[model samples]
Target: MAAVFATINNIAKPGCPTHCGINTVSYPFGIGRECSLDNSYSLTCNTSYEPPKLFPISSDDFEVYNISDSEVRVATLVSYRCYNQRGALGGIIKGFDLNLNKEYTFSVKNKFTVIGCDDYTLIGGADESYVSGGCFALCRKEQEVPNGECSGIGCCQASIPKGLRSYDLTLHTLLNHSDVLSFNECGYGFLVEEGSFKFGGAADLSTNYSEFVTRLESTVPIVLDWVIAPNKSCAIGVNICKGNSSCYDVEGGGYHCKCNNGYEGNPYLDPGCQG
Candidate 1:
């Protein structure tokens, strides 16, 4: 009889320095030029900053907040809406594209909701599918808002969907702020990080409202999923691993690596994990 273990030539092993805090950067992702696939896949941990910023794989200015094997989260700007005394509407916003074709996906899981007497806000725009939705708050008095509730009477909140790429928000006076103009003149809207916000008392509309105006500068944290390619497994046929390494399939149809038993360092490197 032939050898029973003829095809099982290699066994998987651990490589590279572990303990990258909460993050786990495996193959295809590297800390610097020496371990990355290219400049675009690199990550920098900035210890100088107060919260410890994480820079993009190559460029600066685009600060990274969190990264994982399959997903990443970044801080982004939200749009604004303002009106003049003559009743003309004007606003400013940052535009983003969620290119699924390019393998980048966007999501809106958190909401910066506004609550007041007679308010209407709209969050819209995602590719060609233009759909707009918002919340309405009506109340007889300001003291009715309970500790935790968003029932549209004194408070309201909306949940955004997953896989959303682009978004533009607009605030307006659906019923014409004539009734509650004394206490609530302009409504508010913002894209806040999920789980980091809570509903407060009705905005004191007379306090210059400058703080509310700054909502436009806020950014919502979004998660993205990345992959090497579709239908391409490292174990299929070609010997993708450089030397004494093995390949393992990931959740999204991609493949990463492991060193063949006694080696160390990164198997994805030129020399199979330095023993």
Candidate 2:
């Protein structure tokens, strides 16, 4: 739903190819060009639709939410668990992974949050480095969770560290709701966008509610931050920005161009911003 824009001042730096949907590219990210560092660093802007979708390089399914000077938000699937009459879980989940590396890192600015009652969830796995955490929520009765509050009662959230490239999610139920079986029978878990979820009493366990009815329609939004490799800034002192342009270092490494303020247009190409 966020609007996408392209970089101005074509400073002739290595950049993603035009057909690869370069028009929709933004700062901190590029497509198909040496400026992208490698293939995995590029973004794919699909134009099949009206506004088009921006997909991270190497990712088959995932829509980019927003890209800032330091981070990018993406949409990913959630994991769920349900218990049948016999008290056995009726669902199975392998887990979710983001797959980031030295070239890219997940943002610590956001948190991995979950919404639901009678559920225990874990979010882990960052490049096999293995640091993880989770939260549990118990809603014995519908009235326990107050409206607009997340106090680990009916809904809870946890924070993740910065520099992680990937992660996995697993959900489990601590106790069978056979006693309150008629009221609540399922648990849900997923990484949610920061500040996007709010606690409400209405979400508590309810007999009239079923697992199918609680399933979320869309995946949660997760954010990631990327930077050029450290030791790789613009051709060391070569003044990469030729012809009256200025070079600015990207967060991690490499550099971008600007038309020396007062000026406009692609600094990398042709007419360099006329006053």
Best by TM-score: 2
Off by over 4 Å in 1: 1-52, 55-63, 83-101, 108-125, 128-134, 137-140, 153-155, 204-210, 213-220, 230-275
Give all candidates' CA lDDT scores: 0.51, 0.58
The per-residue C-alpha lDDT of model 1 at residue 194 equals 62
Worst 10 residues of 2 by lDDT: 208-217
Predict model 1's lDDT versus the native: 0.51
Looking at model 1, the pairs that clash are 16-265, 42-57
> Which whole-number lDDT from 0 to 100 does residue 60 have in model 1?
55
Error of 2 at 57 (Å): 3.6
Q: Model 1 clash tally? A: 2
lDDT against true structure, model 2: 0.58
